[model samples]
Target chain A: MEQAQADKNNSAIRPVLFCECLEKDGIVRRVAAALLGGYAFTWGFTALGTTCLVALGMGYAEAEVAMLLLAFLIFLIVFLWAFAAVRIDRVWKVLGGGAVLMTVMAWVMQHLLLH
Target chain B: MFNGFRIAMTWVHTWFGLVLGFVLMVCFFFGALSVFDREIDRWAIPETRFEPQPMPSFDRLLLPVLEQQLSPDEQEYAANMPKLHDAGKGPMTPRLELPVDEYWAYTTHRDPVLAAGGGFRVPHPKDPTLENHIHGRVTIDPRSGTVLRDDALKIGSDWFYPLHYKLQWEWKDLGYWIVGLAAFSMLAALVTGVIIHRKIFREFFTFRPWKQTQRSALDLHNMTGVVALPFHFFFSFTGLVIFASFFYFPLSHTLLKPLHDQHAVLEAQRAGLPYERAGVAVPMASVDAMVREAKRRWAARDMAGEVGFLTVTHVGDANSFVSIYRAGSDRVSLVGEGIHFKASTGEVQYEDPPRAAVSEINEFLTGLHLQHFEHWLLRWLYVLGGLLGAVCIATGFVFFVEKRKRQHAKMGGQGSRVVDALAVTTVTGMVIAAVGMLVANRLLPIDLPGKGDWEKWVFWAVWALTMAHAFWRSAPVAQGRLNPAWCEQCWALGVLAIAAVLLNWVTTGDHLIKTVFTDTYWAVAGVDLSLLGCALIAFWVGRKLMRPTTYEKNAVNRALALHE
Candidate 1:
């Protein structure tokens, strides 16, 4: 009788409910990933921009312009990532991860070129 | 025991914040802006937007002008100036030697004019028509005594710093003391808040935006305060220390028994440090040549600029010397040990102690306070820190109100009235004072009898009126049924006043557009834009509060059902 009741209950609920649940989970996952990506992008761009400017140090205006362009591009990517993260549910972890990754990237870039 | 103590401290924090929270908020906000006071001035005044002029070499024209202005007695007094052998004794004597040609030859003239201490100065022509009193450039050849660019007074950042700090009032040291007290209260409130918030860390990550009314306010209060806790602490502590000598340092009489210091010895040391001469002339070296010599001596150290002041001691005696310090370091301390020289022979006398021990400590403290480091990155960080401190104070005020509101709602009338009054001042009263000040700045008649003093009076008068209005309107505001329950009237007034300031500027023909595009595109435009931004924010807040809450809508439905 209990099993029969369970079957009835399952029948009463729409199959779309389960689908909706799955969709929500997928959205959250994507949002988390996007946030991480955005944070990494921002951190990497900031560090690179700082190091590049310092390294150039008025040696050539053209080099500064090029570095600035690259920095702006990174900033654009970071902004998109941040916007996505804010919109997505359960995505802060992604943002944190992204920041960490970007910091690592910046360190690598600084060592390779600036040093 | 601990729980009881926490509860008692919470009460203390609540009352303290309620009493001074709104004023503290304004102080912090203004103080933060003041950190960039110079930059603000640069942004505000349109006419003075240029890279700073290199310091004019003093000797080229001034000395020759001195030669012309001062009598032979003055010349003799200047020429025979004594070595500043002792720190306290005065200038030596003056003498004059005229050269027949470029040859190293001299004829001693014992003219009475040379004996009597009189020096020469080219009378700079004045332009009374200019608004800022900075007209007619004085161009001096750095190597010679010729005037270069003397123009109208560069009023740009000069007025801004004073306005922010003391509103250009110089009397009684009252403004400084008041600001100091406000800073102290702010520090007290910050400390009390930390003590009261038991689950600060746990709540740091919790921000439920969907919460209704009181719950939502609490959440916001916690979020902003917790996120910016470190920032709040740094600003409060550092702000207090910024004026530490003024507030806490012992008096000069008490510390330096000779000066009868009450506060501190250092305070006493500043008394009449710069003194004037007795007008007795002695033989003196050429100022222009001495400057060159000073520069050459410090060329290895790359002293960035000219000495700020040149003092002549014992005018006619052979013991006279000239001290040249780095310019613009006056904000740190007057006595900067850089390059000192014997004016007669151009010999190096004194250089500052190496950046070690006492000197390093002084430099570090002053540098941190003045933000003298060369990097813009550090300045941005400082600005961010100040903003966080403001956020902390603002949220704390809101939290205090929100906590009391629930219990106050249970009271019949008196309790609610008190809370309402506090709320009005904490929120709208501050906005009123700020907008009022700006309005006064523009509207106060510039030609009023004693215009400078009147301008200062207008600010205080407006601030006092704001407090009075808040007190009078408190009861009606409390009884008002608008959701979020704040009287949006004061905020509306603020918005109107801000618009008026812009209008006044336009009417006066100094509108931001003309001043920025046609004249100078410097930072003064930034100040106007910032004021406009504030107006927009105030309007937004007012509109938001006027909207009916979900709870209010539900209550209305219940009333309709009962009527039916």
Candidate 2:
């Protein structure tokens, strides 16, 4: 009976993911995607969001602060989504590609405002 | 990812929580101590044990101190003068000859001394708009206007407080980035923790200490984590929020520098405050009278308060302005309601209006985390919340080890052993270091040169020793048995805590009896009592660890059989 119970516990504790996702390299990539990619996305979001809000006539300080207040929450969401998402490539594309797009938009907007 | 959302979150919660839990332990522990940092300062520096004082007379007392021929901090002058001064434009100004550009004095309700400083301007600056100033600071006895030794380490404020936020690792702001990452991970862990915890409500009241080690540790972890969930979440959230602009993102300084500069000029214009000094040097004003007018105006607005911060911008120039800010001891916000005046004529330049909604929310969040308020009950509650955070992280470490040690032992793996060692180092070893520093402070001669540096060395050395001892004894952990280091270190912590109290009495001659009953200095008395209470708890835990249950014995026998 004890042996049978131990076997049941072992089966219950089996890895949920296939072998590749459980590999060391796979874990590292996922973590990097979560932390670094999430950071890039959040930075771009803060820059663009602050610029857009300022362009919309909010006070500069207020707009910057409002965007900063939301930046971490957004980062937290994407960080978790990186791990939970179905495809690692999709996670990277969304975070990395979105980061670039928003950053360019913010730079262009800033250039217009300055000119 | 092959798992559902819950399992993925569980993986995140377990792994990220484990990795960052060590840093979070330091943050929570030191942060709890920082709630009564001023009180601890009083205990550490016995000479400054007098009652807290209000702001002293600025015109009569502070003016002479500020105007007296003062030299800029040597380190600051050496490090910054070359960068700030364009030597090609002119020779670098002598440290003593640097003209004063700003004067400021700050005091809190809990401060027995007033801290005053002056910013000395660099003549030929590389970037004129930048803060091109070297600073000199002094701590003044409010009652006597005497300067105290600047070398005395404010162990509470200087050491423990910074240790929480930056781990005292200031090399290229590595500590801040590491802490930021840990704080961000903390938020993720908290969210993932909630998703993973299936019986949060049931676990809030459940603490089965008599269960197996894994079960018991999880119970405590769940209980502490759930009970202080709001505190854990808000503190981590607000801590990040507090540094979000300066350290985390810094968008205004980087991406939005142009807009930020524009806003600054517009802000200065709208507020009628000068952003630059006029070349004309003239200082003929009574600052005391201006302070009185500021106080009267505050009273008129139905918020009577004492001055918490006073600053003179563009010092000794026509554009100079004196700004007085009321100490927010009565509320949860930081110092506010600043009133500015023309320094030459004492005419009111501007009075700060109420904050906007966003700024107000920001202030409240930062204020709650920084805790400048004077409510004793709320301070104690915050301490309780901080300790709960520490407990949650510590138990998380224990749960990690307890659940895996046996399996790792069966596999002849050393992962559990290494983690158990580090767990012992951070938990018990960290406390030993802090208490050991207090003991060293009491034991060192009061007049010894660089005594504070010696005390700090003792802290690091003791912590290193404890780590070594923990790792050496962590061998037993590979057998799925208790690390005897945990019990030994608990006793060491207990003994050290008691020694600190006794040494304080011997060195300072302020025994608990005298401090509590006769002298009535609750600051020192409270610290002494807390040390004794800590000793009692540590001894209790030591005693508990000395006794092994059936589970440990079974694991030990299994390990012996495997060796055969």
Please tell me which predicted candidate would have the highest TM-score against the true structure: 2
- The count of residue-pair clashes in candidate 1 stands at 109
Interface Cα RMSD, each model:
23.8, 3.0
Worst 10 residues of 2 chain B by lDDT: B1-10
Residue B516 of model 1 has an lDDT of 70
Q: How good is model 2 by TM-score?
A: 0.96
DockQ of each: 0.01, 0.57
User: Local distance difference test, per candidate?
Assistant: 0.46, 0.88
